[model samples]
Target: MRQPSRQGVEQALDRVMRVVTRTPLLPMGHGGAQAWIKAESLQRGGAFKLRGAYNRMVQIAPEDRPRGVVAFSSGNHAQGVARAARLLEMPAIIVMPADAPAVKLAGTRALGAEIVTYDRATESREAIAADLAARRGAVLVPSFDDVDVVEGQGTAGLEIAAALGHVPARVIVPCGGGGLAAGIALALPDAEIVVVEPEGWDDMRRSLELGHIVEVPADAPPTACDALQSRRVADITFGALHAAGARGVAVSEAEIRAAMRFAFAHGLVVEPGGAVALAAWLAGRLTDDGAETVIVCSGSNIDPAAFAAVLQEEK
Candidate 1:
């Protein structure tokens, strides 16, 4: 039940810097309002997940590292952990949804991690991962539930602050299990934190509005954002975001698609989930009051065919 702190994020930044690349903060403008995009879509492992994944695994004791690690992610976290484990020379077993995007599945596999497919609807990935870890005597690394992971994810926020040479007035982030959003909240205590999610899957939005954690509906509609389909928000993430006075918003599918197109137009490839924050901004769901803002472009792991179809729609 340890809470992530700014100090921990700083330490994590120092540790992850050895492996995590410093992605660019691209300048962008829309409707006369200006913002910076933290293109984590260019990060190693194609997302910011590597920062947390590496920070968590690198802390494992030498005696325990040999047993390897077990984790469950829709896709991004799987690749992150797999890449980190590969760097650390430790084995990784990822429990992934059977229907995860082929690009993500292939990416994790290519990184040399063993994948265990699961039925996301009828089965519990957490249970599968826990049992797998217990049976194999491996460590369990929850995507957003671990303090180390949250702290590690905060490194991006630290970089944002450092690059801007001052704290931004606001930061917009895509929320899955709320890991990245919560991490940024801890990193930029004075900044306004805005968490965005796909419409039907905005449990975190409802949770913050209700002042309690809530589960995604059993009948939530399908979304292209496989990476943001987390069923529930973790206490660790919820606590940090709630304490930071963070607010949440949900964007429509059309908005997400539009944001992806916007990123592409800007010469960046952003997956649907990664574009939700930009979606919110572009759709004017959040007011652009001229304050300095940073919109996080979190990932870019879309399947080529699917991405092509999306692009074709614009043509």
Candidate 2:
């Protein structure tokens, strides 16, 4: 497989930026650091995943496009794939966790994608997606691993640098499967990129340490940040992250909850995944201890119950 070079990723990002909104980078008000939030939570379909979904869709062969596409995702990616398919007038089948967030599930369905619920314990989503693609003669679009996906994700980095006049001293991204961090690194080859994740769900941290992809076992008391559940790191992400000299860090669940509450209290509707960067910042990684930092608030699909709890806690 060819390497997913920074230049290639930049071109992909260029393609996405033309269609997606430039999410804002508002500073953290606590005066702790030069804090900025790339509010991808406000993106079309409510996540940055749309960029990758659409980027991949646009490149599909016209003959293949008629056969449609299939994907497995718990949230944002499902929404992205569905929305992208809608734009291309292609049929889509989204395999999602039965326990997936209602807001996300409904949004994907609303985009005209047929939904297939899978039993997380009894079924393999990958197998389901593969089977669906085969039966329908459709294309399979992985949530994160693919090179086109990473390139699409990189568009955020491209916009970030352009939005900020250039890469700042550091850019902090909320990492689940590593695509976000991988994309940003390629888009801003000159800036340092860091991956921030929840304490127990840090695949990028373990992957970088092991010098290869690593998986977190399924029995780890599942975290509710559904979009952050990519268990394996992608090869393309590995190369881009390594080339950019990326680093990984984790913040506690308590801190993440607090960050979500803080953002909402300040009129920002960030979900747990969206607030990961802010959570890391609150954990002192982004503190001015003193330096400027950009954090990507990548999604905004908070469960109403969880949102209430986030607000209730830290009191």
Instruction: Report the error of model 2 at residue 262, Å.
Output: 1.2
* Tens-digit lDDT track of model 2 for 127-172: 9999999989999998888888888888888788878887777888
lDDT of 1 at 49: 98
TM-score of each: 0.99, 0.95
The local distance difference test score of each candidate is 0.95, 0.83
**Top TM-score: which candidate number?**
1
